[model samples]
Target: MPKRLRLTRRFPVAMTNDAYRRLQSFAREAELTQDEALTFLFEHFNSVTNHENLTARLRLFRAELEARKA
Candidate 1:
């Protein structure tokens, strides 16, 4: 078995009460520590943002092709 390397860093952030509550609820539901919950959220956000960027680029390319054909 291969050993895994761990690199941990800390980031301090301040949020509104509402945001804190939402994060707390998510952490409880997912059975994750606050740090883990935040990591999950960051990863999910990156995926969604990447998908949106790709979709926007595809739309622009299709529009350009249609304009050139006309």
Candidate 2:
């Protein structure tokens, strides 16, 4: 049998009804339980592409800030 990995985290977040409904819809479309869908998203957000995008955005913002300072 393949080994399994487990993670535990705790946090409190507030969401609007619209956001909750969208998450439900995504869960259904992806054929995952709501919790599973959220887990998938958490993993996705940590992916290389996402990290690169965030880095690019931060660099852009820093450039703009530096331009203002100069």
Candidate 3:
């Protein structure tokens, strides 16, 4: 049986529309609610993420963030 999860934190999140759409898609594909999908992702972050790819993407996003805010 799968372990049950209790939501212990709630906070506001802000993301680009593209990112939000991707999150919705992932949640639908996984048959989980958006919150649950986020929880699962964060919980298994290390195992599911590609470290090199994430590092490169983070750099790109950070570089663009300032421009996006304008």
Candidate 4:
């Protein structure tokens, strides 16, 4: 059985009408409910952060090095 997710945060966001329409179109095209689309987006974003966190950290380190040189 799939585990149920307990939502912990509620934040309000504002989007332009164009963005709203595009999101609706994507949900229809992908056959995803709005909640499913949001979940998918969060999962993908987390995956990218997991993969790139080390690289991002290294970039920060490089930025500090350049700052010290300057």
Root-mean-square deviation of each candidate, in angstroms?
A: 11.1, 6.8, 1.3, 8.2
For 10-70, candidate 4 gives per-residue lDDT tens digits of 6786775877888788788889876666666787775646667868987897889767557
Which stretches of candidate 3 lie above 4 Å from their native place? none
What Cα-based lDDT does every candidate model obtain? 0.79, 0.78, 0.97, 0.74
lDDT of 1: 0.79
TM-score for each candidate, following the candidate numbering: 0.55, 0.52, 0.89, 0.49
Best candidate according to lDDT:
3
lDDT of 2 at 4: 56
Tell me the TM-score of model 2.
Answer: 0.52
Please identify model 1 stretches exceeding 4 Å from their true place: 1-7, 48-70
Off by over 4 Å in 4: 1-8, 46-70
The residue-by-residue lDDT of candidate 1 on 5-70, one tens digit each, is: 342778789885887999999899999888888877775876646787878987997889767567
**Can you write out model 3's per-residue Cα lDDT over 1-42, one digit (the tens) per residue?**
988799989999999899999999999999999999999999
lDDT of 1 at 52: 77
- How many clashes does each candidate structure show, in the order listed? 0, 0, 0, 0
Clashing residue pairs, candidate 2?
Answer: none
